[model samples]
Target chain A: MTMLPPPTSKKLGLVIDLDICVGCHACAVACKEWNDGGQFGPLPDANPYGAEPLGVWFNRVHTYEIEPKEKGAPAMTVHFPRSCLHCETPDCVTVCPTGASYKRAEDGIVLVDEDKCIGCKLCSWACPYGAREYSEQRGTMQKCTLCVDRIYNESFEEIDRQPACVMACPTRARHFGDLGDADSAVSKLVAERGGYDLMPEMGYKPVNKYLPPRPRRDGCAAEPTPAQEEKVDFSTSPLLRWIDKVLSR
Target chain B: MRPAFSVIFFTVMSGCGYGLLFLFGLALAFNPAVSGRIEGLVQLGVGAIFVVAGLLASTLHLGQPQRAWRAFSQWRSSWLSREGVASVASFMPMVLIAGCLWRGADATTLRALGALLAAFAAITVICTAGIYTSLKAIPAWHNRFVLPGYLLMALLGGAAWSWLIGEWTGGARAQPALIVALAIASCVLKHFYWRHIDAATPASTIETATGLGRFGRVRSVEAPHTEENYLTHEMGFQLARKHGKRLRNIALLLLGPCTIVLALLAITFQAPLHWPAACCAFAAAILVTAGLFVERWLFFAQAKHVVMLYYGGARMHDA
Candidate 1:
């Protein structure tokens, strides 16, 4: 029963743009807020009021500083948000001893059937992305369900049908669409921006993609050009000169 | 990689139990030393206690202990499930063999069942080792040495306990040289395993992790969260180099040369000083078990998980 299902053609996933992300914890916080009220609600927080508070979160944001290759080049800061990739060959699902952890065949969204989970914690270990979170209170494993409830809800508006994290992104750095469709908007963005997979050598074949930061521009190149200075010259314009004389009177 | 006490105890105690049971089963099948009732009682009693105690200890880490029976359902894909099924099946033949000894039955049934128990125990140990080796996430555990190292330690522990039983029951003369040889072999294999892991490189680097390999260098400017999360807590355990070296030395001394010396003394004075021989054998068995525990602890503490790259761990290749 733990054997993986055949590969599906439709892979629903997110595309994260590193260039525009502002290192804000909005995505992480939005994820927690929405999921806490939806399926797998109320992510347990043990010792929340104590000196050391601990809780489970499905998404996390990390920041990194990449030093420039040239001596005078400026350093770049990259904010990385990590979550479940819903891999094509998820080791977490295969390593599971119970049928609780499984991938959906219809949409390729990996989910946990909490009713059947034994809380063995093997799935968490098998995941390279640290996607699965163990809830001691529920005695089951939880992870990003790609907002299956909201995305598939018929009552919601078309624009409100995306994941909470994607909708809440101020810069629109997070995008949700059918990554399996090469002609989809998300896929086109990936192609244009040179989007890449994280740790591709791991061979999980992650459905999610990340767009690398664009090349940094030089400091002086942003200054005004000589061509712009030729415009709005009062000395060369007769209308501007007449307006200046009338204002002086 | 937290080296939870429950898991450490489960692996060590169960390994020793399986090891001891294996030797007793082999002896019963090939030789006729444990034909007497008292010898059979002592052998079965020790083996059952260690094995059962270990089995119980393994459940301590489980969040839902009552649901453990469900683990046996997926033996085809899970080594843990296979271990559960194999270990439970082994007890069937073991208990039946014990019953035969209790009733003074024929040796033929006992011998055949004993052999079956031996095979099952070996398989269970292998399955347990496979649980760690099969993990591609942890580079240190996913190696050629893990399987052989586990088996060697099991054999060594079993041989030591068997020698003690032989001395106490006066049923048979255990070959001390064989115990010493197994101890030596385990120590040598452990040394090579340490060297191999030390020299090995991590499969992925920080650049590869971020898909920024085209860029020159990448470093973390800030952490995702201020507080520790499940991933960090479970996999962030770090063992200091000094402590690791000291523990390795202690384990080597206790398991290798010290055990060899005690075993040699027992062999030299078995006839003239039976009391001293029994005492020495008992002490050596205790030392070997303790040493193996330390070794297993290092095995977990020293492992580096790939998830650490997201945290502030230096490049995986740097190790």
Candidate 2:
């Protein structure tokens, strides 16, 4: 039963823009908050007040400092938000032995059936992205559901009906829509921004795409200043003159 | 890649068990007159105990041991499921062979049943090896060498156990020699396996990981979480080079040359009722078990998972 469903025409996924992201952990926190009490609620935190604490979370944000490759190149910070990409050829699903892990035929959202999962943790090993989280307390594996319960909810306004991470992004850097549709807003964003796949060489064919930060402008370039030999330039400023007088004494 | 005690015990103990059963079945088929019925029963009983104890040890790692039966359902795609099914199925032929021995069946009939039992035993070991070999995510495990290493170790361990039985019952002179040859082969194969892994490179890098190759060198300034999480705890084990090297030396010295020498000594100078041979065989088993334990620990400790790229380590590149 862990056999993957046939490729769905509707690959609903998220498109994350790196340029506007401010490295705020709102997405990760929002994901935890919503999922904690939502479909996969109560992401337990073991030894919450102890010296060493651990918990299960569906999303995480990592920050990287891209150092200058050249002598005077300007550096940049990239805040990467990671979750399950809902891959087309997810090894997590295929490696599962109890039919506990599976992908949906309609939405392409990969999910783990807590009831059937034996907590063998093989699926966790198969995932290269480290997206699968095992709950030691519940004895089941949990992962990013892409907010399935809220995305299709008819009671909520269409504008509010999206992944908690996307809705909570202050900069609107995270966009959610049908990625399979060429004309969808998310697909258009991907096309215009040259969105790329993370670990494409891994061959998982991740449904989610990430838009790389735009090229830094000339103003941000680190141009080396010429060394000047001139001295005694502070003669006109009284504060500098007083400091110079004190230093001369 | 954290080496859980349960898994270590399972692989080592079960491997010896399967190996012993394989040799016992082969002995019954080719040389029924080599030993008496009592010795055969003892061999089968020991094999069964090791295999069962190993299987039980494996279940200890599972979060829900009550639902362990569900693992047997996905043999078509999962090597683990196949192993579960194969191990259970193997019990049938083993029990039948034991019944034949108990009834003092004719040599020809026992030989046929023995061959069937041996085939089942070999298949079960292959399935066990396949469980680790088939994992593509862990490059350290996914390889041709893993299967051969496993097969050879099982054969060697089984031969050693059979030698002990033969020595006790005054069975055959060729048996200890066969065990010595297998021990030598297994040690050589294990060394090669270690060398191959030591020289291997990373399968993926941070540049490829984030699709930021065009940008300047990518390096982590901050992790996603401050405290350790399940992923880090499970896959982020790091080993010092000095400790790893020392452990490897111990394993090689004890399991390889020491065991081989002990086994050879037992065979070279035979005594009445083979008492000296039996003592040497017992010593060899203890040495190999202790040596392989260290070797198996190093196997997990030294492996660097691709997930470690997110943590701090050497950069990975696209395959």
TM-score of every prediction relative to native? 0.93, 0.91
lDDT of 1 by residue, B1-319 (tens): 7888888888898898889888888888886446477887787778778888888988887877888888888787887788889989989978888788787677687778879988998999999898888777888888999999988898888788878887888764347899989989999999999899888877787888888657668888788878888888888776534388798888899889999999989778878667988999999989999999999999888777788898863865443
What C-alpha lDDT do the candidate models reach, one value each? 0.85, 0.81
**Which residue pairs in candidate 1 have backbone atoms (N, alpha carbon, C) closer than 3 angstroms, thus clashing?**
none
TM-score of 1: 0.93
> DockQ (Cα-based) per candidate?
0.68, 0.56
Interface RMSD of 2: 1.2
Q: What is candidate 2's lDDT per residue for B6-110, written digit by digit as tens?
A: 888888888888888888777778977655767777888888898999999999888888888999888877778888888888788788877877887788887
Residue A166 error, candidate 2, Å: 1.2
Residue-level error in angstroms, candidate 2, position A206: 1.4
